[model samples]
Target chain A: MASKTALYDQHLAMGAKVVDFGGWDMPLNYGSQIEEHNKVRTSAGMFDVSHMTIVDVTGADAAEYLRYLLANDVARLEVKGKALYSGMLNEDGKVIDDLIVYRMTDPGVSGEWFRVVVNCATREKDLRWMAEQAARFDVALTEQPELSMVAIQGPEAIVKVKSVLNESRGRLIDSLSVFQGQESEGWFIAKTGYTGEDGLEIIVPEDEVADFWRALAEAGVAPCGLGARDTLRLEAGMNLYGADMDESVSPLVSAMGWTIAWEPESRKFCGRAALEAEKAAGVTQKLVGLVMDTRGVLRGQQKVIVEGVGEGEITSGTFSPTLNVSIALARVPAGTGDQAVVDLRGKQVPVAVVRPPFVRNGKKVFS
Target chain B: MSDIRNELKYVASHEWIRDEGDGTVTIGITDHAQELLGDVVFVELPEVGSDVATGDDAGVVESVKAASDVYVPVSGEIVEVNNQLEDSPELVNSDPYGDGWFFRIKLSDASELDDLLDAEAYGELCEDES
Candidate 1:
């Protein structure tokens, strides 16, 4: 049987179409997925993202261990509550998973703590990998399964979330900057979201999650499902762990070269040697965004022909609800130009190869 | 449970046909099919004044989740196609049996309708699939 979250009953009561996602029963949509997508773009929507795995890392070697384990430098987190997006790579410099790590405490604090949230489908392997590496370090890994998370996103998302919070919690929301998360009254509220909007991702205790969800609903926050979440993340140009990249795919070619902290040549991180060698040898493939103004949806695994350049396959593709057009991310030959054609159901349809982030703040940002 | 109109005939593939009593029939996907497809973003219909064979690959319906191939139920000449769906495909989700009708066909073999499932049998098929 698939596992159920704290809000499973509430989802059923709200007429959600439940599907098995990563061994857990999650809502796909309440009714119209397009409406849910529009709601997030125009106003506010809340998603029950409790299936994400939360790991607490604490020890004297917390910072150092993470700096070596992840591609992103942890030393750059100069302030408490600051979150950093990183790609966890295997020894070969291939991406294992993408995660957001938050510095939970100050640098000088005892048992310096950091929190990392990874994808639910990759939880077991990630935990095993972290422990295997921790055998040589002084860090401890603890999985917090007692927590449930909700992401309130869009223009009015913060206001709706704040309406349900107490005075001190409300004050905390106001004080937070982007990419900042803080614990208040047993809840971790962060000004971070997968959707390209000003919002909050709040981690609450399992016992309080249902009631909190109800309160947000009463405050006029639309209940969004995983369907909307996928489109939103894709629109924001964020990569899905398994779909965009895996252990066999290098981060350099997966649109994650920026996450590699190449500065300070002395600091050696995992997969650094392999990445450096690949970069020196000249990376062959690159991840780029594709836009289709014509009919038909662009789906994953479709062949993209770049004419003079080599062929590439789409990693993630869907119809953009905001722009009323089809958009996708594909791994193409590094030399590919701005023009390409996708073999859409046996028809070679023209498409424009552009930079990612097709939409930001609910507006089309891609030219 | 999805609503099944007793007056309409259904195919196991989820297409519903309504006899217009004028030697022609209106065809559309069933409500159960629309519910399964989530939000319909685009719909491809057969061209008007075209000949289609029974069980031929007719058109396609693209949803937010996936795409499904729409099949021709009976051999006929397409008399008219729904043009409103070009700009508003959500009509398929809003009114699957009414305004969402895909095409009207001048039946070449009206006997083909006998092979289609009735409302009761179609309900049973949906139940079995679920």
Candidate 2:
């Protein structure tokens, strides 16, 4: 049997199409996926993201433990409520999972704390790995499964979210900078999102989530689902962990090289040695964006033949609702040219290679 | 709930056919099919002069979630196709019975139409799937 989220009844009442996602019965769409996608792009939309795992790390060695566990340097977070995006890697420099770590207390102090949010599908593995790493450090790890999360996103998201909150909480939300979060009245609100739009991701106690969701709905936020979330993230050029890369592929080739901190040369992170070796040897493949030039849809696992170079495959592909064009993220040879041929049903169709972030802030960012 | 016209003939695969009264038939996917597909982004129509057999794969409808094959209902040569779908495939979701029609076929055998199901039978089929 699939598990249901705290707002499952609300989804049913809103006429959502429920589907099984990573062992959780979740809403795939409310009515139209495209409409939901457009709603987030144009106005405001909300999603129930309670299935994500939220782990709180606190102790004297919290920062030190995270420094050794994640590929990025968590020491860069100087202020409380600051967040850092990092890739949790195995010994082989392959991404175990990508997550956001929020600093709950100041650095270099005993009793410091941090919060890590990871994907639900990799919950067990990530928790196990985190515990194994924390064993050596003086830290305590606690999984907060009693929390429910909601993401409100779009250009108008901030104002609309304020409309549903108390004056003090609304003022706190207004003061937050991008990639920042703060705890207020037992709730954690962050000005961060997967979609390339202004938004707030709020994590509240499970018992209080239903009322919060209803308030947002009453405030005129469209109820979005997993379908629109996927499209929005793809259009923003963000990677889906399993589909884009996994334990077999390293960050060097996964468009996640920026997440790796190579400075200081002495961080000694889990994947530091392997990534250093790969960087010295040079990488062969890289992830890039693709726009179909013809009237066809680009789908994942499709063969991408780079002229006079090696063939590659699409990591993620979809019809971008904002651009009204087919876009994809493909992993191809590093030396691949600006144009490649995609084998669509045995017919070779041309595609243009470009940088990612096809759409941002409800506008086309790519030419 | 979707609107089902009593005058049209339907197949188990969710396609509908209408007799044009001049030895020809207009074909389209039922409204229920479009609702199941979410939003129609692209539709690949068969050539106007191509001959099709009943139950053969004629074309495809690609939505944001997945792609579905539009199967032929009655055997015939395609006479006309809704070219507007190439630019605006949402027509299939907005007006599936009229402007969203896929193609017109000059029936190779008009008698084959009897093999299709009535609206009531098709409605029962949809209810079972749900």
Candidate 3:
């Protein structure tokens, strides 16, 4: 039996096709996947992201503990309510998970409090890892499973959300800049999203999530599912934990070198040694974006050939409803060409390799 | 809104055959097969001159989500292939019973048509799967 979200029963009432996702009963889509995908690309859409595990690290040692635990430096966060995306690494330098750490300053959410939102699929592993690190630090680690998060995304996201919140609270969130979060009305509202769009992700108590979701939906925000969430993230060039890199891969070889902050010689972080070694030694493989010229859609684990160097495989691929083309993120040899071929069944289809994030800000960024 | 014309013989696998009254028999996948496959994105048919045995893998039908092998119902020589599907593969999703016909075979055994399921039997087979 899977744990149900606060909106689980409500999802069933809406005729949602519920599936077991990371031991949680969640909606894959309300009815049609293509329609849900299109809704996020064009207009405003809301997603029930309550399954994501948000852990709080607090006390005087929060910053030092995070520096030891994550590959990225949290000291970069100076202003209150600023969020930084980082890759949590294991001792071997393999990516444990990629998540966002929101620096809270309102005393209620931060000061001593630092929030990290991890993927649901990696929730258990992430929790365990955080505990093992906390046992070594003077910090108290607590998992707040009582909160529910709703990601309202697209060009009209802010407008749709602001229309529903309390007048004074709405002003606070509306005044928030992108990549910034603030505590208001006992909830943390962050202007962030996985989709390549302007949006706000609101964290509220579980009791209020269903009503909030309904309110957003009634306000003309489309109800999107995990399917669209995935395509949107892939289109943004953000690598998923299990699909892109996991226990065996390094940040240097993976598409996460930028997440590794090399500045400030005094700051020591986990995986820094292995990352520096990999960067100096040269990485064997890299994750690249590929757009299929052929008609068929590219899929995960499909074989990719880089000519003389050898073959690689696609990490994630799908037909972009926004781009109207088959786009994918592939893990190929670092020396792979501007042009490569994907083995679709028996036939080899040519694909153009370019920088990741085929689409950005709900528009095509690559040819 | 569905028509099960008596002139065409149906197979339990959802394949339909139109007996030309000549030696050659034209065949195509049924409407139910196209519906099960959400959207047809690509198709690969057997060579026109190749001899195919009944129940052998003759071609490939790829939908947006998955890929399935297209099996030949009756053994014969491949005569004509649907070239238009190569340009606009979604034709299989539109006119599956007509323009989406996969391939036509010059019959090696016309008696094989009698072995196929009729309209009533094919309709029942669809219900069973549901």
* Interface RMSD, per-candidate values to 1 decimal: 0.5, 1.1, 2.6
Q: Cα-based RMSD of the predictions, in order?
A: 0.8, 1.8, 4.1
Ranking by DockQ: 1, 2, 3
The model with the greater lDDT, 1 or 3, is 1
List residue ranges in candidate 1 displaced over 4 A: none
Best by TM-score: 1
Output the number of the lDDT-best candidate: 1
The TM-scores, one per candidate, come to 0.99, 0.96, 0.85
- Which 10-residue window in model 3 chain A sums to the lowest lDDT? A104-113
Number of backbone collisions per candidate, in order? 0, 0, 0
Colliding pairs, model 1: none
Docking quality (DockQ) for each candidate: 0.88, 0.70, 0.29
Off by over 4 Å in 2: B1-7, B119-130
Candidate 3 ranges with C-alpha deviation above 4 Å: A106-111, B1-53, B58-64, B73-130
- Candidate 2 falls in which docking quality class? medium
Per-residue CA lDDT of model 1 for A1-367, tens digit only, reads 9999999999999999999999999999999888999999999999999999999999989998999999999888989999999999998999989999999998767878999999999999999999998988899999999999999999999898889888999999999999999999899999999989899999999999999999999999999999999999999999998998999899999999999999888889999999999999999999999999999999999999999988999999999999999999999999999999999999999999999999999999988
Which is the better candidate, 1 or 2, if ranked by DockQ? 1
Per-residue lDDT over A1-367 for candidate 3, one digit per residue giving the tens place of the 0 to 100 score: 8998898877887767677899999987775555676788778988899999989888878888998888788788877788888899987788999999988864334456689899999988889888987887889887899999999998888888989988987888868888889888789999999998999999999998888888888999988777778878888888888988888898877789888988886777877888878878888899999998667788889999988888899988877667767888888998997999999877899999999888888788876
The digit string of per-residue lDDT tens for model 2 on A1-367 reads 9988999999999999899888899999998888999999999999999999999999888888999999998888988899999999999999999999999877777678999999999999999999998899999999999999999999999999899889999999988999999999999999999999999999999999999999989988999999999999999999998999888899999999999988767889998999988989989899999998667689899999998898999999989999888999999999997899999878899999989999999998877
TM-score of chain B of 2: 0.98
lDDT of each: 0.94, 0.92, 0.83
